[model samples]
Target: MARLKIADNLDGEPQTAEELAVKTHTNAPLLFRLLRALAGLGLVRADEEKRFHLTPLGRTMRTKGDGAFGDFMEMFLGDQFLPWTKYVDAIRTGKTQFDQLYGVPYYEHLKKNPDERGRFVNGLKQMTKIFNANITDYYDFTPFKHIVDIAGSDGTFLINILKNVPHARGTVFDEEPSIEAAKKNVLDYPNVKDRLDFVAGSFFTDPIPAGGDCYTMKSALDFEDELAIQILKNIRNKMKSGTKFLVIQTVVPDTDEFHIGKLFDQYLFMLTGGKERTKAEAEHVLRGTGFELNRIIPTTYPLWDILEATAV
Candidate 1:
């Protein structure tokens, strides 16, 4: 991953191990060994000329491609590395390891460091591009006149949804930095820029913007029960009684199924005071927060599901 970033695949040139080591500021011999392993894995190949070229699999980690797996890789390994190393301890204790490792809450740490917050938010933005594509293609938004995305950075999801709805306007309720980033990176598209509004505040404290027929939370509800319910209750206070609510999340299955969400739940265990909830747990959480489960909308993706609900 570091090599992909160092090579900056946009350059479209094969690099010698020496050149790559220099570019990435690593020892040439060490870099060659790493590259050789990657070669063995077939993510890259070396020519007789001793120049390494990215393979199709390697290109998946380049930002130039249609895939956002690069950002996903960076976001996880870059930002969440330390806490993940302590996952074993977290699993044994059922406590947050992020706060323990960092000496502050993850969100609090973010608020104090704008650069990291920007990187993390942009990572999510990159991933959002693909998520929004699948959602707009498969879901129906024709009947909804307005949409609000909680903690939606750059309004990417809302912008895509509004593009489809045409007449719909949307709100992005997120951090101030995220609002700025969205303005610069996401809302420039002519279709939805004028129709989108950004409300800057922490969802843990603020009331969500009102008058939306739908509220979307994409990985935003991965908080402990009380805090998650507080956000829902806050949204409920501002929303009309019958407003639709959507949680696009890793809703864990109750079975001893060998699903990836189980791994994700474990990762969440390391980073948060939350775990991926089962359907019954989801229903319980939502019910306490002024919402009722309408349906669980399955998408083509296995790790994510759209849990539809109605504001009570």
Candidate 2:
């Protein structure tokens, strides 16, 4: 639907497969079959005349605009989806199958492929819209005058934070691609535009920018344990004592009750050799990394929680 721009073409109006095909430049017969399947999925309604009307649920698949997940769906269902094919192998070897299949880490592959990188970045941006909603309301960010987002992709999270905490300034420390995206995205929020700065570098090698009373790593530390600990140590070495480190990620629960993080844990391992940590697991990593786990604050979003730590 996203690839053919079906949702965008439908625009809440009923149209025959031929009409949709004309707009999407697809085969009418095949398009009709696709539309029929979509109707079965409740993404569209097929009338007696065989015309298709885009359902409200289907409108979310539009490639752009508010509440769209077209790119997000495309990313997960496209290249990223390939990693899951090696799930069994990954479990047997306890390795990131994506690295084996692609001959590099996922991020490295993205850097080498511009088209896939764009899709991945855009997909994360869309995901931020879904998962990071009203995060500021849940967490008190006003206490910190300066916040540094480590490996903050596209600065969307920092932009949102700065918007809520007007008195605070933010720095997004990430790679060149992400910094470039951040530059363009910050323009949309004129209120926080001037206060937001972009620093292009890898968190693994580059010295973390200093003077931030609070440092945040959102969806960043879902890597191998050694790497995650190294990142924490790096931040600890650079920042002053009494500063806070906020790890915005999911904490898998021990219970059988359903949690999205459990599902994400498998995908993280498949793609990056990472696992979504449970509370105890999260604290274990934070311990002896020059920080003390202060609290775990849950936000409205189920997949993200803020593990607040203090630099001792």
Candidate 3:
């Protein structure tokens, strides 16, 4: 789908099969047959005149719409999809199928392939955009003089916070490539650029950027228990007493009831040795890593929550 930009091309207004194929450079007959199947599935609607436009469901497939889920579709349907082929191998051997499929860990594989990294990062961008849009509205940042976002890709979280709380200055900490991407994105907000700076280093290996009263990480702890605690400890080591730390993730619940985190945990099981955790499990990491759990703030966005903590 990303190859021919099939869904993307269709979003350029309704078109006949000939028109779509001509615009997208595909065989007209074959494209029409494919469109026919999609139409039956309610992804697209056909007019009596044979023009096709996106159904409400198909709008989610476009690359530019607010509802656009193409980034996720690109990632899951590409590199993330490969592991499912060896899923049984993962279950049988109790290992990450992604490592089996790519001969490297998931993160290392992305480091080797820039194209795949871009797609995966785009998927993250989508989720953070949603999280950032609603975050400041719910969580007060006014008390903080300086804020640090650990592993903040593209710096959207801090950018939104800096905008909302004008007295606040923010630092974005991430790896080299993500820091570079954040710098480019920062250019779009020259007015707020002074309040923002980027740091390039490993959150696990490097010292956490110092002097921010508020430290935040979003969706960064979807790791196995040991590594997750280690990551929190690394951050805790840098925090002065009373420094506030915010960890945002899809906080699962300890229940047999159905939840999206249960599904996300399964996806992680196949792709990495990581898994989503319940609120209790998340709080355990805080206590074990030398931080005091303040509260778990659930958001209007289901499954996502902020675990507020403080360095002891």
All models: lDDT? 0.79, 0.86, 0.84
Q: RMSD of candidate 2 to the true fold?
A: 1.6
Q: Is candidate 1 or candidate 2 better by lDDT?
A: 2
- Error (Å) of candidate 2 at residue 48 is 2.8
Model 2 has an lDDT value of 0.86
TM-scores of the candidates are 0.93, 0.95, 0.95
Model 3 per-residue lDDT at 22? 92
lDDT of 1 by residue, 135-187 (tens): 87767888888899898887777778887888888889888877886787553
Ranking of candidates on lDDT, top first: 2, 3, 1
Global Cα lDDT for candidate 1:
0.79
Looking at candidate 1, what is the lDDT of residue 67? 65
C-alpha RMSD of each candidate structure in angstroms: 1.9, 1.6, 1.6
Cα shift from native, residue 60, model 3 (Å): 1.3
Tell me the lDDT of model 2 at 205. Answer: 78
Candidate no. 3 TM-score: 0.95
- Residues 1-312, model 3: lDDT tens digits: 445677788885899999999988999999999899989988888899999988888877766668777786777876888888887788898888888778898888889998899889987776566778879877999999999999998888788888888888999999999998889988888767998988899887898899999999976569887778778888988889999999888888787898898898889888778988877777787888888889988888765788889999
Q: Which candidate comes out best when scored by lDDT? A: 2
